[model samples]
Target: MDGLNDYRRARVAEILADFTTLQFYIAAAPVDPPNQEDYYTEGWRALRQCAVDGQHILNTGADTHVPITKGGLEEQSKAELQQVHLDALGRRHQGQKIYLRQAAAQRWIELRNGILQGKKPAAEHQASLQACDEQLWLELAQITDEGIYADLQAADIQMGRWTGEDPSLRAVQRWIRSRR
Candidate 1:
């Protein structure tokens, strides 16, 4: 934390505090019976390791010089937490994979339509999309759940559904618009 600018030093201090809190929670977590090839458990392990890595960065809570790093403890912690979320989402939607697939297709169409109409960024993207065959483009609607999930992952977009009693499409449309 030494030899750094005031802003960087403050940011590092905040990150370190977050790591300490995360470490405490990780240590206090109940022991879950291990499941074979469990992605959720693996994510927790990665997160726990990230907390431990932070301690190393801080020299076991001793004051230490930290150099600027893109792949530091903070970055790894965020990545691990995101993985945990994705894993949970996949598990929860296992039964409604078809629904998720359809939703993903709809999102795809929405994105492409925005780009093609110049409602979204990149005119070059619009030109490329315009050249796409209309019939072929609609084929995205028939993709498998795995295919849809792959697209979401590659795009770094989180996909999920609302189960609220209100069946209004407005909430969903607003969400899509925000993303665009």
Candidate 2:
């Protein structure tokens, strides 16, 4: 009985140590835009592992008395950390959306000019415009934040008006607006 209890306690301690390491990694993850998705994925994985290990420790029935909040393993702390990761992801996506919007606008102008000057057929111009619209919609879809999604929807509506591309643009606008 004594040995079994000792083994359980040791196991709990080991799991807690691993959980703490994951916590540190999550807290210190870089916010670089290019690698933001990878960082967020790693942070989310670590958070999930910590939660699983914490549950396992609780199930062991060992003489574990660690206070989660004080030790930086509390549920509230995890929630706060997850929020930080989410906000970082939102910022990165927002920056990407801005860049894509500008590029799409420039491309639309060039395509329209080509069509008007007979450098390209109207059908070719329309196809190019449709591709650009699709790319912008895809970029917007990658963002998960509701506020950012709403902002992108408004921007897309404006872009549609400026480019005089109504049908496909209106479809994208409706889809984005309907998303929660």
Q: Best-fitting candidate, measured by lDDT?
A: 2
lDDT of each model, Cα atoms only? 0.37, 0.38
lDDT of 1 by residue, 1-180 (tens): 222233333433433443454445434433331343322332233333434433333342221223445766665444443333332333222212333333343444455555556343356674555444343335534555556444534333232222212112333233223322
Q: How many backbone clashes does candidate 1 have?
A: 0
Task: Estimate the lDDT of model 1.
Answer: 0.37
For 89-137, candidate 2 gives per-residue lDDT tens digits of: 2333333333333344344434444544644335746666566456545
**Weakest ten-residue segment in model 1 by summed lDDT:** 159-168
lDDT of 1 at 137: 39
Candidate 2 TM-score over all chains jointly: 0.26
Query: Best candidate, TM-score-wise?
Result: 2
Error of 2 at 136 (Å): 9.3
The alpha-carbon lDDT assigned to residue 150 of candidate 2 equals: 58
